[model samples]
Target: MCLIHFQYGEHPIFQLIVVANRDEIYDRPAEPAHFWEDEPEILAGRDLLEMGTWLGISKNGRFAALTNFRDPSLPKRPRSRGEIVRNFLKESVHPSEFIDELAKMKDCYGGFNVIVGDQNRLMHYNNIFDEKNEIFPGVHSVSNHTLNTPWPKVVKGKKRMVEYLKNNPGQVDIDELFEIVMDREIAPDEELPDTGVGLEMERNLSPAFIQLPHYGTRCSTVLLIDRVGNVTFVERTFNSGHFKFEKSFRFKIQK
Candidate 1:
């Protein structure tokens, strides 16, 4: 996932709301979000090459998402960062415990930011910076760096999310959340972050929805969990900068 905006425990009716986009090369084979056949409790998009997931939720209210840090100077780790989400979903450990354990062996994976939680609470952990935060829930965004790092797209998306929820009090227009993730407007050069990637690459990645010659956003995922333990997950897939199809799932949080 490249850009993610989520609010937990901030609204009257909703417990958790998330809007995220997964950006990758056009040809990376991936399975759209679904209940994994082998692990029926998990619902998420599959990274076929790595046999892992970028984001997902379990039938019992467990949720997790992963994003890679934007530093090429870092060495490649033996493990795929995507496994962080997959392992969190597959395990029954408390969110904080899971993150604490990972922190002890953080160097096994490349720089990454991951969020894991249930309806009870949310936690943010990054191996690159050796940081773990208990998210308190107004509105938060994370990208290819730390959580709420003030990157152009992260700032813009979080602001839009706060406004969207405020404007549409008591109800969430799922499609509107999709609109936020679909934004392709590149940020003004002055607002772009210099992450060591040259100016051209930075500009290319400045937009919430990235579109490049051979690589771009593959899917946008919107997940809403209500206070009553109901979940609505929607994923829209794209190809060559065009909308392809959408897959949605609605289930009650078992826990």
Candidate 2:
């Protein structure tokens, strides 16, 4: 997932709500979100090339999402960062322990930021940074940099999220949540962040929803976890900004 905008512990109905977009080359082979045949308890889209996932949730109320830390200086590592989310959901481990172990092997992976843990606690980790942070209550976002870094899209998404939640209280509107992440408005060049990517490329990637010709946002996913341990996960896959398919799943947490 390249962009993740979410609310934690602030909403009355759902304790955790996640809206994220996955950006990749259009030709990269990937499947829509589904329960894995091998890891039956895991539900997430699979990266066909690496056999890993960018975001996922498990049967036991555990959920995790990831974003790459954009840095042109660092060379690609031996591992796919997607494996971090995949492995977290596949194993039965505490969040703290998982984060500690990730720190030990941080060098093995490329620059990336991960928001992981179960419903009760979520932690953020970036290999370039030295610490793992406990995601506090309220709206938070993460993209190609650190979490809540306030890039144009992150700020726009978070503002829209807060307003939507504030105005439409009591019940969750799934469509509206999806629409927030579906925004395709490109940020003005003056506001674009200099991530070492050239001005033109940065402008293309500035929007909450990117629609480039060969590379862009491939999918958008919204995950809702209610106080009663009920989960509603919806994912929409696309190709070059054109909608292809959508998958929705709901289940009560095992624990």
Candidate 3:
């Protein structure tokens, strides 16, 4: 499970604020945000050859995320979760329209919760076994459920996010937001959402060192989009594997 906290058009000079966590199995190889020779303009990760990223943003003001819908009973399908992120970054479609397109392809894949947004709009999509839904704008949280499933983690994460937003308001920059999104230390007794892997193995195989690897916050990122169409992006990762995020960069979209 992953969390994203963002505010659009809330700051004086900043037009957008984003903070997110990239959650995945500890063993999955991944690179930090970087531009690949194959995909030059893409800056989040060269070729994230692991699970889909929880969130990403493009210089064109497009942003997206993919979350697995908890379903231990459903049979797994033959699809690449990474493709979801690739498709979103490679395309320039609007969030709502992109979600509509995703719904049509739902049958081709397994259960998932997806969010795509920009400075002007945001949308969510859910495809469980028998139920499906689209989330509307306003403060909302998407975890293993469709959206706001009342799961303890979902509820607590949303509440914490709201409290942070309320207290920080316009002053909530990327760094502060990161602390909130990566706040796994809070409420230690709160049961964490199981990642399908056993707790024992999770502890052993998970990334341990926050700076090197084997277990820790895998990646932290922030994407800002100003009203004038300028974008600022930053990403950091722990460990050395298939992923490595380059230094932060700021750029503008061609009008």
lDDT of 1 by residue, 138-249 (tens): 8999999999999889988999999999988788899999998888998889988888989989999999998898999999999999999999999999997899999999
Q: How do all models score by TM-score?
A: 0.98, 0.98, 0.75
CA lDDT, candidate 2, residue 236: 93
Runs off by more than 4 Å, candidate 3: 9-15, 46-54, 129-137, 186-217, 240-246
Better of 1 and 2 by lDDT: 1
lDDT, candidate 3, 19-127, per-residue tens: 6656565667776666555556555653356444456666666767666775567688777655676678778876667767777777666778777766776666776
Candidate 2 residue pairs that clash: none
lDDT of each: 0.92, 0.92, 0.60
Write model 2 residue lDDT over 159-197, tens digit each, in one string: 999999998768888889999989888899888899898
Greater TM-score among 1 and 3 belongs to 1
What global local distance difference test value does model 1 have? 0.92
Write down the worst ten-residue block by lDDT for model 3: 203-212
Q: Where does candidate 2 have its weakest 10-residue lDDT segment?
A: 166-175
- Return the lDDT, model 3, position 126: 76
Output candidate 3 Cα RMSD.
4.6
